[model samples]
Target: MMTGTIENRDVFLANIAKRFGRAPKTEIDRPTWQYNPQNRVLKEATKNELVEVLVEQCKNIHTDIVITNTANLPADLQKVVGNYGGKSVITWKDERFQNYALSSLMTEQWPLENIQLYEWDSEQPEENIRQAEKANIGITISEITLAESGTAVLFSSKDKGRSVSFLPENSIILIPKSTIVPRMTQAARWISEKVRNGELIASCINFITGPSNSADIEMILIVGVHGPIKATYIVIEDQ
Candidate 1:
């Protein structure tokens, strides 16, 4: 029988969260929106409709929308983005998912020659943030360690800057199907444990569930008032 030290991950996370002053709540109840896989539910709708849905969420507040598909971006839709004065950016995950390529923003045929790529690193978060501001669509990779709550926990310590995901007009996350999880608590626990063991540390960690939104203005529904007004999660099954 193989025996080893079993870390108290939950407790460890709790302590880390407490120290950070942003510990998530204990409430574990929420409605779950199951993304059907067998039929590819998202594909049922026209790509235009999907873009409309994302655009409507912005309420004409933000001009740019970020995305993460480059290699095989929808042609017609890409044209729309181009006409709309959108900028597309490119990002690729590490060796783990090297085959995947992503592009964002521009609707028209992407100028493959003009596309710029960035690798995840810690030292240039400020520069990344500056670039995100200039870009309408900010695309990047996800660590995807925690899957519950349809969240992607990206690391921006030195490899990837935190601002790459935040501080943009629209934030689109590309999460492989394998990384989805059922609860935010599970993610919190994992983060805490990792930090406790010196596996991860950073100035900030962003937990984005959906697009940037707030309805606090006199009960008026608003999105992207503060951060990226649009949030789209492209859940691609492991290939």
Candidate 2:
């Protein structure tokens, strides 16, 4: 499977630098923002508080929230899938599925019988999108979750297809409570540090909230026309 980690970072960076007629720099200077108030927003909040913040934000995002743990994830996920009509389901090929015992849940543990399940296969790129488009629900685990905006920063890799979150009728994100943060500022700071250190990072990052609805023309609300009709965030509290 394709991974986001770039092992030979120097060689990789040098190739790009050669095109620009310059040598790759070994270090990067961090930026100093004078008006950085983002650090103070929910800076003192505990993990529980962060989760609460996410819960409150979800109220405005049209998301169905569920609080669960590793041990109980299977049951809760099954419940959500069943509620969404689990005739067909697609999910990312993440190790967390095995850690949370959800591989079995998708393969066989659904309370409803005859549920068709699919895991996004990196090898078959076209097939992945085709299956996702037909899936009734698409599920994925969040890499970084934002409490302030109720957003999931999905670091898309080959194993984690971007289409899974958007192609399906319903989107279900599994968030580890530990990954929850105050806002996008923290997310940006983290990715910046990783990039500076020449560490592995995703080529494409998708910031997704609950299904999008537009209300631009004189504040007239419109739903279910642009994206998934429903989205759910299942927060694993003790991951």
Candidate 3:
């Protein structure tokens, strides 16, 4: 049976090579193309320009952008939650969030008296995911922000999971200005370097541009088909 399977695979490869009008080459070409023109212009973009572009592009895609300082982040988040009337909140338990003292602020603003707040728990993943699904608002910290596409990059791990971003009705991401990159290429390079340095790489890296949408059913555009109905980005000027 194994011999027959190998023969069938060889025949399939031969057929593909014949269709392409070339013999199957066993070895790949060395020194692949490395020049990327898109990165050149991005390299020249100023930090302020990148911020402007990100905000503009995000707005074009129906994502709201709020620029504030680190001290005002709590206030900004309060406003976002208030606008959506979010009662149930799910958030990442990242160190950056801890340094910002966001949990205390959130508790003060949206107390247990009216709202329910849940943090990501590694031990109780299933229960945490269920809580995330029930939450009206999901809050997460972005590792990188791509200005060219207005995309926020999130690395999923024990402290931060993918469900927190997708299961909620509204998604709120906090981005530090320092983490904003010019484009996806730069972001990729950064991630690659981190992995090369033996860092604890995440199982999944999610690049979120805007709120989920689809035009598959009768060509009518529908938002929140696969993810959050609304996406909001809060860019902190100083980390």
Candidate 4:
């Protein structure tokens, strides 16, 4: 049976090669051309300028943007959750939140007596997903932001589940200003370079532009059909 399957695969490939008028090669060849026109503009953009464009594009896509310094992030987070009346929040298990002292602030703002705060657990994924699905807000860290299209890139690991940013009514992303790239092409190049340099890559890389929406049923627009209805980005300038 295995030999028959292998022969069938070979026959399929041979047919494809014949249709293309070329011989099937045993090895794969990587492309040599890699040039993006936006790289120059991206390199010339100032941090503030990138933030401006990013905010503009985000707003255009119905996503909110908040600019805050590292020290004031906790306070801003409090405001955002307070405005949304979020009682339960799920956050990624990342140390950057600890470094920014968000845990303490979150406890103070949403005490154990009033709110439910959950963290993603790598070992207990099913439990984590269950908790995250019931949470009112999902908070995750974005390593890269594309200013040109207002896209935020997230690398998913055992510690950082993809559902942490999707299975909630509201999604909040924390991004540092330094990680803001000009476009998606640059972001792809950076990831490729990281892989080429022996850096450990995550199992999933998500590029989220805004809240999930669908308008397929009719001309009417609907939001949060597949993911969060509201998306907020907290851009830290000094971090």
Off by over 4 Å in 4: 1-35, 38-43, 106-109, 217-219
Q: All candidates' lDDT scores?
A: 0.52, 0.88, 0.85, 0.85
Which residue segments of model 1 deviate by more than 4 Å?
A: 1-86, 90-126, 145-149, 196-198, 201-203
Task: Give the RMSD in angstroms, all C-alphas superposed, for model 2.
Answer: 6.8
TM-score of each: 0.53, 0.84, 0.83, 0.85
The TM-score between candidate 3 and the true structure equals 0.83
Query: lDDT tens digits, residues 1-239, model 2?
Result: 87687698888899999999998888899798798787899999999999999999999989999999988988898899889988898888888888887666756334466888888899999899899989999998888899999999998998988899888999999999989999999999889999999999999899998986789769987766766899999999764
Q: Output the better candidate (1/4) by lDDT.
A: 4
**If both were scored by lDDT, which would come out higher, candidate 2 or candidate 3?**
2
Please rank every candidate by TM-score, starting with the best: 4, 2, 3, 1
Tell me how far the alpha carbon of residue 95 in candidate 2 is from the true structure, in angstroms, after superposition.
1.0
User: Per-residue lDDT tens digits of candidate 1, residues 22-91?
Assistant: 8756776867668635344334444444444444433443333334353443443344334434555533
Error of 4 at 153 (Å): 0.8
